[model samples]
Every structure is written in C-alpha cells, then in structure tokens.
Target: MINGAHVILYSHDAEADRAFLRDVLGQPHVDAGGGWLIVKLPPAEIAVHPTDAAQAHELYFLCDDVEGTVRELTARGVEFTEPVTDAGWGLLTRLRLPGGGEVGLYEARHQRATDL
Candidate 1:
C-alpha cells in the first residue's frame, strides 16, 4: 500500500538553494504554487543504521561512478566539501548546497533496494 516518500532538506537561503537544484543539479521539479518547487529525485532506497549516540536521518544521491559524477558536477560549479573516500559500503563524498547545507553522495558497493 505504500506509494512514495518525500524528503525535506532544511535550508538557510531557500531561494538560492532552489535555484541551484533547478539550474546546477538539473533536478526536474514542478512548481507547487507561489514558485515553491518540489523536486523529483531519482529512484531512491532507504536503510536503517544503528547508532548509540543519537538518532538521525541523512540523504545521499546514488551513482554508478562517484568519480565521474563528481567530475561532471564539479564542471557544473558544484563544490565538494570533502574528498571522496571509500566507505566500504560505497565511495562517499559530500557536496555543499547553495544554502550552506551538505548532502552525501555515494556509489554503493552493497546491494541497493532500488534494484528490487
């Protein structure tokens, strides 16, 4: 019965961030009135990780090639906040959004739910 999921990224400068998502990342979106854009992300997967400190949720964009994706995004003016590192489960990196928030990007080495 489950249909879909909606993810929210809180931002400081939402207009600028929205522009980046639309222009730089090229995320296809629809305006939900008053210029509020709702982005359509690529196929998604979810995982639950156990933590002892606190509970939190994070979002990451999956790719087939982290290095290549990074290269393409870099050419489009995306700023990577960290170098890509092999995280055992994937090759991982973080990219800075126009609003100063960071999101993880990875090429998964493990099974992905999207394959289902």
Candidate 2:
C-alpha cells in the first residue's frame, strides 16, 4: 500500500528554489539538516498533460479556493498566466514562477473534502 507522495523539485539554485517552495508556494514544509526540504503538498488529481520534462508530467495542485490562492500569490509578486476560470468541471489558474516555470492550481466542480 502507498503511504503518500512527496515531491522534491531539483534546482541548481537551491536557496532561491527553497524559498520559492516555502514562501511563494505556501506549502507547509520543513527543512532538515540534510540540505533537503520536505513540502507537504495537498493530494493531486493525477491529470494528463503534455510536458517536455524527463518525467512524463508534473504535479497539479487540487485546491479548494483557486481564486483566493491566486489573490495571495499575486499579492506576493507571482505572475499568473490566467485568472481563475471555469473549465466546465472545475476552476483553473496558472502561475508563472521566477524562473519562467509554471504551476497549475485547480478546484473541482464537484464538492469533496480534500485529504490534505
């Protein structure tokens, strides 16, 4: 059985990336003495997407408040690719990071308590 999933992003700029993951992304994470940080991301939806990375795809944040999260990130200087919009089944928001990387935040139309 799978206990859970933990994602550790690789970055040449460790400090900046650490801060970005901690301060910018707002995930509850902890930095231990081993020069690694552990971020507790909410459970993901495992959706399909096209990406050019070594891995097939990336993690998508399944949020309950896409609008509020966007507001917070925008207030903190994160650039957004699009405002929260209805996608018929859910709400979607895309954010542009400091290194031109982007992450998608989503809220499902169907109501369900998240396991975060």
Candidate 3:
C-alpha cells in the first residue's frame, strides 16, 4: 500500500531553494519540525526509459498549457533557461532555480496515467 512520493532537491543554498519552492512555486508545505518544510507535490506518475548511461531520475512539473504556465511563472520572477520545445511526448522547458540549478517543466501531449 503505497502512500505518496517524496522528492528531494539538493541545492547549494538550501534556504533560498526552499523559499523558491514555498513562495515562488506556491507549493503547499508543512514545517516538519525544526523548520524542515515538506512540500506537497501535484499529481504524479512514473515511467521507465531505456538508457546505456548510469541510472538517474528526473523531476518535472506538468501543466495543461505550457504557454500559459510559462507566462504566469515569468510574471512571478521565475527565469526560464530554455524556451519551450516540442519533444514528441510533450512541450518541454527548463526553469532556473534560485540556487543556480534548473528544473524541468512540461506540458504533456501524451496521455497521463494519473487521470485513471
């Protein structure tokens, strides 16, 4: 009986990144004692892709409309490092995080299992 997933983003400036997630992204979170904020993510799904390289995982935020989402986030002072590009499965872009890292944001054109 799986409950939910907890994702961690390692950052050089943990406090700044936490503020970005809490304030900038508007994610609902709770102080998990001692100021450890645990964020509640949106609906999520996983997929398996083949690769020859070492095993790695990625995190992406999904939206129904990439253009609209981009517009809104841009207004919120979020910087997008990449313009949206159609990747067959979705329209993808990278948003620059406050700690000098980037996260993936996409509007999926493919069917989502989360709707099931």
Candidate 4:
C-alpha cells in the first residue's frame, strides 16, 4: 500500500532554504544525517493535469484562507512575490523561498480531497 509522498525542492542554497522551511515556516522536521532535515507536511492531495508541453511537476501549499495565511506568514518574515489574486480555482499567490525561488500558495475554491 502507498503510505505517503515526499516532495523535493532543488535549491541553489540548500542550507538557507532548509532553514526557511524549518524556522520561518515552522515545519516539524527531523534531521536525517549531516544536517539533512525531513519535514512533515500537512495533509496533501495530488492532481493530474493534461499538458502538451514538457512533463514537469509543481507544488503548491493549500490554505483555508489566502489573505489570512498571507498575513500570518508575513508576520513571520515570509516574503510573497505576488499578491493574492482570484484564479477561478482559488485565490493564488507565490511565496519566495530563501534560495530565490517561489512556490505557489493558494486557498482552493473547489472541493478538497484531503479527507480521502
């Protein structure tokens, strides 16, 4: 049986990004070895979208309220690269990672599959 999933983010500055995930995001993690941290994520779901371009995978953090979550994260010193905007499926924005990359953040307007 499939137990769980692991998402990896390749970073130019791995340590700084790790610190952001551990300290800024306040994610619970355990050090594997040599300061490598494995983070515990909240409930997650996956979707398959048909595309004509090259195959790739993207990650997005789902929230209950985009504005509220943005405010909270801002207070914690997180930087957002974009303001939240309605995107039909959700209120979406991008948060900057310490390694100079951004990840999508959204509060979905559709039904959630987290209970599954």
Question: Which candidate achieves the best TM-score against the true structure?
Answer: 1
Clashing pairs in 3: none
| lDDT-based ranking | 1, 4, 3, 2
Clashing pairs in 2: none
* Model 2 lDDT tens row, 13-116: 66676677788777787778776777777655444666686665554577778888778778988888987888898999887656556677788887555543
lDDT of 4 by residue, 38-107 (tens): 9888899999999999999888999999999999999988999999999898899999999988899999
In candidate 4, which residue ranges exceed 4 Å CA deviation?
A: none
Q: Residue 106 CA error for candidate 3 (Å)?
A: 0.6
Clash counts per candidate, in order, are: 0, 0, 0, 0
Model 1 misplaced regions, further than 4 Å: none
Rank order (by TM-score, best first): 1, 3, 4, 2
The per-residue C-alpha lDDT of model 1 at residue 92 equals: 98
**Residue 4 of model 2: what lDDT?**
72
Comparing 2 with 4 on lDDT, the higher-scoring candidate is 4
Residue-level lDDT of model 3, residues 1-116, one tens digit each, is 99888888988887888889999999999998888888889999999999999999888999999999999999999999999999999999999889988889998888897898
Question: What are the per-residue Cα lDDT tens digits for candidate 1 across 1-116?
Answer: 98899999999999988999889989999999999999989999888889998899998999999999999999998999999999898999999999999999999999989988
Report the error of model 3 at residue 69, Å.
0.7
- Pairs that collide in candidate 4 are none
Backbone collision tally, model 1: 0
